[model samples]
Target chain A: MEVKEPKRRIPLVGILSGMISVASHLFRKPVTVQYPEVRPYEPERFRFRISLKLDDCVGCTLCEQVCPNGSIKMEKLVRENPRNKRMLYPDVNFGTCTVCRNCEEICPTTAIYLTHEFETARTKNSFLYSPLELAMDEKEVKK
Target chain B: MNDQWIELNIGPQHPSMHGVLRLKAKLDGEIIRELEPVIGYLHRNAEKLCEMGFYCDNLIYFDRMDYVGAMNMEVGYLEAAEKILGVPPPDRAKWIRVIIAELSRIAAHLVWAGAYGLDLGMLTPFFYCFAEREKILTIFTEACGSRQETNYMSIGGVYQDFNDKIIQEIKDFLETFPKRLEEIYNLYVKNDVFLSRTKGIGVLSKEVAIAYGVTGPMLRASGVEYDVRRAEPYLFYDKVNFEIPISHKGDNLARFLVRFEEMRQSLRIIKQGLEKLPEGPYFNPKAKKSMMIRLRGDGEYYARTESSKGEFGVYIVADGGVKPYRVRVRSPTFKNLSILPVLSKDVMLADMIAISGSIDLVFGEIDR
Candidate 1:
């Protein structure tokens, strides 16, 4: 690594160009989107809160095993499926979840998926979704 | 020791400061005499946690390590893990990794540019830079599931393939970003105030930078033609043709120019990568689920990737077990930050903010 001499540029020209750049943007449409009324574009794979489909779940326990932060815990559920012998489903603790998508990736079935709902805030301190609560569809999760 | 010296502490909380960095500076008549960076505020003991989990489970920690450049961080860790496992990702995956890594570099640089502007008492550029960054984040969201902490890269390959929609999105970004980048560049770089605040400020000499183990754009700005992507030739970097931009100034202005040039190079790399992207399976399916859960390897390997900040290297000491025996991260910001004391001497108190911002300190990576 060797040092070379620095280049000299006209400060006046730079300032004028910068001013022109800023001025040009004044005529263009503002990039900011008004929230609550105008929703920003979220891609198809936009991940946020965890949603579970009880009908497709088979109590594989893979989601629980793959959760890095212990956010997902397997609980005994009364609902039984032909594939599920133990009748277990995942209970997601959103308070600890980093939304890393590990559980979704490891799931044997596409039962556990991430919803595109960005607004997961609640008045309560912690968000603990039980087996039945986690089974909410996209529409219910949105609500 | 002199009574004339006044001790000042600027953040673990401050509006202008980047992240949760706390700077303890000793000032004498508005000039900084001595400075020490107080870290560990954002520490999660990530290295220690990596030792407790399975190999695949630890990738998320890398995502959090450098949250802005999560893709690059993941690449570093996975490269080392894959080396030990002796399973290489498919050609398409390698190309995809390159594209994602370069995009992350651009995004991280955009943040640094924005935050740097904000530190220098300019607000408009911050908004402008972030607006540009939002588009890149959308690309990440489409490729991975998350935007900032994208846990996209996986061992033996990436988690998902780039769909045509995602490719089109990237192409759209590529088509529009350069012109927008020029506008943003002209908005700040050529401005009299920005230049005066940055030029010839916090000059890190070549010897001092090398001595302090500085890497990435900081090192490049000091006239070091070293890039891990080029030097190590990881993935498809050797296949791509791009110049390593360097400046001998080693000052804040030089760093800004270097980063701007690097972004252009990154755009070129992404364009080339998209063109050369092969058609194949993204992941090496041979690396089974059981293998991922309980990976057993007996070796120590260190892999380095040029993150947006600098060289984000990961050292893994694996035993014949499910978990790694030890994982050590060579986070670039940590080493780059070590030179703060060297650069801060005899500089104005206000200039201290400019200097620190130029270094692009991320406490998550540093404190980890």
Candidate 2:
């Protein structure tokens, strides 16, 4: 196909206006948040790391069954709830977890929940959370 | 096989090729003699992987398929899955899906515009377009949890409901977005360099586009007014009143104009959807629980949606089991990218980038 040259408009007017428009942005504050120092606010429903309520969990193993990636494994805990006979709580392997909130939604007693803990990266490859570790909040995870 | 003809490979990793697309072009001096698109560099085998998991597990994979337009991708898969189960989402949920999907289209177009500008060596508009895109991502974050790979849409309906805060934020966005859009449009469209670079750069004929199975904005840019939302009318698209912008020019500039107009149309659709927001449950009450577990189906179904890049479709074959027998994606980018060799033939080497960038190939969807 032959290349056709369209009717061209003068660049001077467009160039000056473009420069002025860009110059106007100079006064505005930079939108970037300082990482490792200032943390941005996450919304209430933000899905990040998984947490489980030890008391509320009935050990039905529904969360373990519902997990798509086989991240959740039902393990027997030493200090079990007296209400529960099975004494099995879900231990989530975060290395395999997709954080899709399938377990949180499928939980029978609102036990498994997702916290707004954005900083999930660590030195270790294995991020398996035991029943005790799963019960801790974001503040505790930071500690 | 001329003595001066040189072979050039422009990235599975280069800056301008868009995602992981590599163009193997035969160059006669600066003019391209032949061009072959080398795909599968970013392939994750999402189709085969979908068959391994439960029906619901495939939703996350859909999210990654078209990360820019995840809502549209999810909607396409869910539509196919819902067809097998013989249940549609509730009215409110349908409206919510329409609103969110349109928002995603605008967001996707914004990314395209920013990237296209960057490809053409204009840095100012990229930042401006992304700044506006950030506002849309913020709305997505508030409505659903995540911003870009938002697994917001579910099988029966949506995972979350729209609260008052989210609604208000959308309204605020609708109000401010037009001015920002105009600002960004003026930054580049009026500029002599952007106009000259893109105006007559890549001219795709109407017949060639249709024969190659091109759909969405690219097809519309070639003056083929075929949009899945208008033609097929999925979700609440039939209920909403919107226009499909078409340009007969069929050049890189025409594609840019068509996409920009599409963003405006998306804004219009969102406004209408929000205005006619119904009061009801977001999820289909009957299919909600059963769909999460073993959604056994005996037949095959195909579902297509007007995604940002083009017609994103999902074809599912189920065999009365927990897992799908087979899942195939009719990704529009794949079809849209097929015509690249045709368009790139005999064009200037520099203009090849403009043409390819205008086509908007997301390797995730194209290679999936």
Candidate 3:
């Protein structure tokens, strides 16, 4: 008669995985990074924060229109220059900003665009950006 | 005399399915004889749609491919379009993208871990996963206006910067998450029922996984060292010191284990990125040369990134026109999901759900 050999068992298969989860508790230096002191390395090309140079902007309102979630709005501005002529700048709402960069892409003069500095969190409800912060002239405009 | 074979018609809209998925199974009492998946229930023809719109317009459509990890999917496409446009975003933007992408990965895994638990009849873990996910999504909402399909990563960089308040929120989340993960894992992972249901079931050898073109946790479960973030470094992944979790078992349990480890690694990557945040321009200031962005007819390039699911590749073939001549999207869910029919054969009927969940198919991306 032929003898049937016994099947060898594979022992402790998923044991390491369970242990690794437990071992993580020990000697794991605080993985948390203190904000500001140890800031996240935002890439030079990261498209987080929105910054505007206003000088490169035109009154096309493409940025306002192309926004996916309607986060950006372009208000017509009347600026007093040397000749007392009127100029325009877009007023942005950080609260509603989707960060899709629709304004940056649609902007004719590239004045309104996304910035690599993605560090703009605020606790106050009234900290939204206005036309003055995004326009060439430092004066706030509501056109 | 009675027939032994039984024909089971699993409907197109099953609750256990990841998205819209249909399976036709042939059974012999409790054992499955064969299984066939009828896909494309939600096909939007994403590739063809991408060819019709402007480069920026296309990114929005691409974002919906992997809805669980929409931002990560969009970033790869956004980068591809910018690469072809011959514009390199500032390093600060790239670093921010990495931080957000890693965070997005954690968010996606949270959903997966929760949904997987729900599929396996473990109700508590799913809720726990979602509760933690809510915290992550809250941070995402502050950074990028919308909740789920956040169009956060921009063409040249991100939509906004991470201020002190948001950074502190991330810090709090990181410190609390590892403990949260342990709490949930201890409940479900080591449980005898959970292991019995997953262990030694739906086994896929490492060689078979490679043949199926499966990447991410599924491939890593089979002991393959191929992560797009590591092999082809994009953003600031190179600077983050972390290991790609892997397992030799190559079974349903291994896939679950791989995702668990990846989540831990994601926290490490996020911490590294947060520490290295730079101060610079988030948007490009160069003057626009034209309203319409034309394409080059000379050469075609393929851009891919390691999304939460797996690899998302965008192949853009331009003919020197604003619209692409042809576009092909290689979604990881579509590729990773096809392995189901092969594994489902000869497996028990109850175990089929575990196997299918382990494959992690999102029909939206698969059909697209």
DockQ values of all predictions: 0.50, 0.38, 0.06
Per-residue CA lDDT of candidate 2, range B28-100, in tens? 9899998998899888899888888877778888888888777889889988988886667898999999999
Cα error, candidate 2, residue A124 (Å):
3.5
Q: Chain B TM-score in candidate 1, rounded to 2 decimals?
A: 0.98
TM-score of chain A of each: 0.80, 0.78, 0.66
Please give the TM-score that candidate 2 achieves against the real structure.
0.95
Question: What lDDT tens digits, residue by residue, belong to model 3 across residues A12-120?
Answer: 4334544565465467564346987897433334455576775555666566545544567666666643321335556777776656566666666677766554445
**Residue B89 CA displacement from its true place in model 2, Å:** 1.2
DockQ winner, 2 or 3? 2
lDDT of 2 by residue, A1-143 (tens): 11122346675788788899999999988777897798775676777788888888888887776677789999998665775578999998988877777777767678888877767665556688788878886567546
TM-score of chain B of each: 0.98, 0.98, 0.95
Interface RMSD, candidates in the order listed: 3.3, 5.5, 11.5
Task: State the displacement of the C-alpha of residue B348, model 3, in Å, after optimal TM-score superposition.
Answer: 1.2
What's the best-to-worst order under lDDT? 1, 2, 3
lDDT of 1 by residue, A8-86 (tens): 5775887787777778879989888898899888799888988888888999888887788889999999876888789
- Candidate 3 stretches with Cα past 4 Å from truth are A1-143, B1-3, B287-298
